[model samples]
Target: MKKVLLVFCLIAISTLGYSQISGGIKGGVNFANVDADGDPDGKTGYHVGAFLTVGAAGIFIQPELLYSFKGAEDFDLTYIEVPILLKKNFAKVLNVHLGPQFGFLTKAEADFGGGSQDIKDELKGMDLSAVVGAGLNLPGGLSAGLRYVLGLSDIADNDALPETKNRTFQIYVGYKLFGN
Candidate 1:
């Protein structure tokens, strides 16, 4: 995990030296769920984040840092996630992106009727996911997009438990803070 993060950082830093840099802040709604032994009900959550784009000529490298709320049914999980994406633009108005996302768990809880219980210890600290999405770059540095996050690593900390992974669909709006 450390190595993967290190590589991503190195790539991002290297691109900054030659690319046309742009950045922004974004926030959105999340429809989250867990794919496990039994199909769990989806839950509503949210995410807020900042992003940096490094590149030009219709292709870019975009890296984002986000705080995401996710889970399913009675379970609630919070994560600080970093996604490094390859983005392609069309006609200066439409774009598509795909990437690998690394997530660090911050909190976990399960609500049963009257109260909630901490379940942080039962889950892994890190998660790996694949993200794919499309967006529209509007006038005045505004943008809107939709994405699907598919978990690739099992989140269960115990061998006795069935494999569990997070799944999320996100709808977001963003405004560029600086650069082109």
Candidate 2:
């Protein structure tokens, strides 16, 4: 058992060292949807975040901290979200990603025709989602990625109320801090 543990530890360390573990900041726009019976209203919510990327031969792990706003038209729901993803690289410039995401609600607002109102008490404060996407590395250390985030947890607290989940499409531009 000791021999096996030692071997595993060494392999883990070597893998980390082999992978390009780079940290940087990222931010982007979220095209968001509140999943209703039909196509939910589309609104542009924004997000800003930082990410840690660990990339190796053909795989990478990216974990991000983001402030995200997502909701349908006339509503503004904001939260802080954490997403961890596993990525598979197909080429030096292209990769695919998928993972789990969770969020804590910070604020909620609704636009009445004449004014806006807060409705934080009526909704759930926590959100959970699954994310999948792909990315392309561009010239000058710039990278672009698109992700689809599907909400798994209901946003409504009352079971009798209509349950709505969120679907968000995010496009991000990232810059690598370390060069290859």
Q: By lDDT, who's the top model here?
A: 1
> What is the per-residue lDDT of model 2 for residues 1-180, given as tens digits with 9 covering 90 to 100?
999999999999888767777777778899998886656578898898888888788788889999998888888889999999998878678989999999899998888797889877878989999999999978877788999999998997776658878889999988777645
* Residue-level error in angstroms, candidate 2, position 36: 3.0
TM-score of each: 0.89, 0.89
The segments of candidate 2 whose C-alpha lies over 4 angstroms from its true place after superposition are 1-4, 37-40
lDDT minimum window of 10 residues, candidate 2? 33-42
lDDT of 1 by residue, 1-180 (tens): 999999999997886676788999999999999999879899999999999988868899999999999999989999999999999999999999999999999999999887999989999999999999999999999999999999999999988879999999999999999988
TM-score: model 1 vs. ground truth: 0.89
RMSD of each: 5.5, 2.0
Global lDDT for candidate 2? 0.87
